[model samples]
Target chain A: MTVSLNDLVFVAMALVIVVAATGVVMLKNIVHSALSLILAFVGVAGIYFQLSAGFIGLVQIMVYAGAISVLIIFAIMLVMDKSVEKTNLFSPNIIRLLAGMGLTFLLFVTLGVSIWFTKFPVVPAEGPVDAVGMLANLFMGDYVIAFETAAILLLVAVIGAIILAKGAEDKQ
Target chain B: MEHLFINIADAFTGWLMNLGLSPWWADLALLVVQWICIVTIVTANITVLIWLERKVSGFFQERLGPNRLGPFGCFQTIADAIKLLTKEDIIPSAADKLVFRTAPIFFIIVSVMLYVVLPMGDGMQIVDLDVGLFFFISVGSLSTICLLMAGWGSNNKWSLIGAMRAVAQMISYEVPLALSLIGVVMIAGSLRLSNIVAAQGNIWFIVLQPIAFITYFIAATAELNRGPFDMPEAEQELTGGAYTEYTGMRWALFFLAEYTNLVAVSALMATVFLGGWQGPWLPSWLWIIVKTYVIMMVFFWLKWTFPRIRMDQLMSFSWKFLIPVSLANIFLTGAGIHFFKWMGW
Candidate 1:
């Protein structure tokens, strides 16, 4: 009869995420599927907020929910309509379905075991005074290399996308 | 983040405890008040910005805009609201109705959400996450999905081109926008907007990072798709662009959303780089209002002054000029900071 706020947020987020993912999978129109994927990503971001990962939650909403979804939709727009909705897959293979089911079962089992065995600890929020400086130090000191790598990765992506889009324009 | 909320909540609870009440009631009261404040500010801004846009545009063109209805056409927006509410909502014959109906609302809401993290003054922000600047840029990017929805949902080729243009413009400009801010973030040594403002307490970012500031200003203007960068809605090229099929009230929603977003981005720029509400004599909120309106006016001025840039040139400017300069600025900031620290400044 009594529902905790966090529990309610978690359940609602999960339901929305599941519905969105299923919508993404089942939509016949590629564009509609891309839009559904954005909704699903947003749902995941909601769950991230509920899990108390403030930085991760915003990044989820921004990078994946915002940027990548747009990229996917833009890519969908570039391709000519083949009406793949009806013939996207040639006859659903039973083996593929079984493999998918098996993978899902394994994932659930592993997740359940982790949930049962692990004693999760909530990390206390560092006082606001130390927090900003601490984050800056983390990124600048220990994770400097990773940050640099991410910048490089973004550079590579920009180059590749420009090449692809430019080639298409030239062809046209 | 938990402690941050807890402290704010505890301050209220501490007051309640003075009155000999439990902390739970104070926490509940604080939540209700903050949520209400957030909704009020966002809705109020959207409404006022819509009216302001029409008045500004009319003044720029030598005509009184919507002046027949209310004092100085103030309530023109109100009449427009009534018109929209009473109009029959039409779905295109082959349009995806669900997405079409939902897209505008999402666009408005997402744009509104970006303001939550934007600080109007020192310590006057909703959330003070360490990644506030990054968070703001990221949230703004979500509008592209809404654009794509509006485009595809219309089932029109023009709409689709407009949406595609938006996607290209936003993504292309995002690099320089984020990169320019890295210089500010480097100089400030923090990504928190409040911290950035406080860092500029003595000297603003514009003084130390002028190149980055200009780069950021241009990128922000482009990001909002204003004036010369307003290729997505360039009427001549794309026939009203992505919202080509939209008519009546649906058209108005897009118009209102665009102006509101312009205000949001301008307010954000003022906060992050313009020393946000920090000024002589004036109160913080008033300073914010003055700076925001000034930026909005500049937007209107640019809209009237310059012709829209060709799409290729706009994209080329970002990739060729802005991106390279921003990259250099980032390095300069890093070296500058290191040199200052080494010199014991």
Candidate 2:
């Protein structure tokens, strides 16, 4: 057996994602945590790239790392009180840590049970990577209804955002 | 003949094999060499772009631009680079050192990595991924996080405000930008840059979809944070905005990233709308350069012509006008394509 460059890259990317994700939760500063979250998001995008899913990888970067991270940072900046800056971030107490451990255990058990109960879907073996075409076909053809529903959901969100902005304007 | 660059590269890699290097080593070397070339080209182009923008701005204001250093101030940027190199990097006492140091590096990396999907000419891309346009756009989206990092890391209230405004502006304009390109993607039926270019052989996408072109240009300008939409760097209002605290070479990297992004966007406009590298007589790469410069000039003109709009007006215009217009353009394109097909043309 021989190791290939692809395997090496996949390992590196996976490690980066895991480490960065850990940093996200462990960091004291919210801003640093958000930045760590961006790194984690980028690593996940890299993993998608390694899977030859270029379109999904790019969308991941755009949505999660780009828009979501920026939104999170903006929200943090806007809502954070000044006094919070001076104080050290509160570490979780033992009871809270135990609670978190319990939740993680529950999630793991749920995932394992589901995996054991359900058979995996058969994935097609057509190996050529026409990711863009395949994704576009899926989106516009078989998943057209789901796609349109997503668009409507976004439209509703936009309208809701506008109303919220207008209400703030009236208050001013 | 069309595969001139590809042939030269194949010959070089083959030579590396003859020199007793393993295939993997040669391939790795080739990859490194290609990345270095790309980075060098981007850096060199940024220098030229900075000088050109200055000259263009000067011309707009009816004055002589930088005409002293090396033939119409061609070397002005190089001199500025050296000056920046010698300057001391100052981190504010209150700044988060980790984020502050990393922000500009991330910004520059994102700026340069945009070159990966760009097709220099036919058979001339570094890596011609199938989703080239999507990759281009998604990479462009990541720059907002860089701005956010820069803004927050500076630890200044004004910087945070600028960063917040930037995030809002970028994310808002992003919708219109993506929507504006849908008509082109629909007509071309491919997301790859080379395929998109090939599809425009008979007629450029700009001619076929003028509405989409207009919307794309406007949204891209906003995305670049150039003048008229430059709330992030509105000096009079925000006092240099998110970059207020950065000094020395660190500051210069951010500036470099800005111009690099400018060039990248202009190149995208050429590839998607104007026929990319598709002119007769001149080599294809040269044609791309000419087209890209032409588009860049228009961007510069827009920068000098329009005054910055109010922040609220900017966001409103993007959401209300540009997004709807782009959506309509897509609808019209689909209908028009069907009509043409029905007419047997």
**What is the fnat value (0 to 1) for candidate 2?**
0.84
Off by over 4 Å in 1: A1-3, A84-91, A106-139, A143-172, B1-51, B58-72, B121-123
lDDT tens per residue, model 2, B1-345: 566777777888999999999998888888788888888888888888889999999999998889999999999999999999999989999897888899899999998888888888877788877888888888998889888888888989889889888989999999999999999998998888889999999999999989988999999989999999999989999998889999999999999899889989989899999989798888788888899999999999999888899999999999889989999998999999999999998
Q: How well does model 2 score by local distance difference test?
A: 0.87
Clashing residue pairs in all predictions, respectively, total 0, 0
**CA RMSD (A), model 2:** 2.9
By DockQ, who's the top model here?
A: 2
Compare the candidates by TM-score and give the number of the best one.
Answer: 2
Which regions in candidate 2 have their CA more than 4 angstroms from the true location?
Answer: A83-93, A109-128, A157-172, B1-4, B22-24
All candidates: TM-score = 0.85, 0.92
Q: Give candidates' CA RMSD values in order.
A: 4.9, 2.9
Per-residue lDDT tens digits of candidate 1, residues A1-172? 7899879999999999999898777776666677778788888988876765656677787678777656565456455565534522323889988888899899999999999999989777543554546666899899999999998999899889888878644554
Q: Note the B-chain TM-score for every model.
A: 0.88, 0.97
Residue B249 displacement in candidate 1 (angstroms) = 3.9
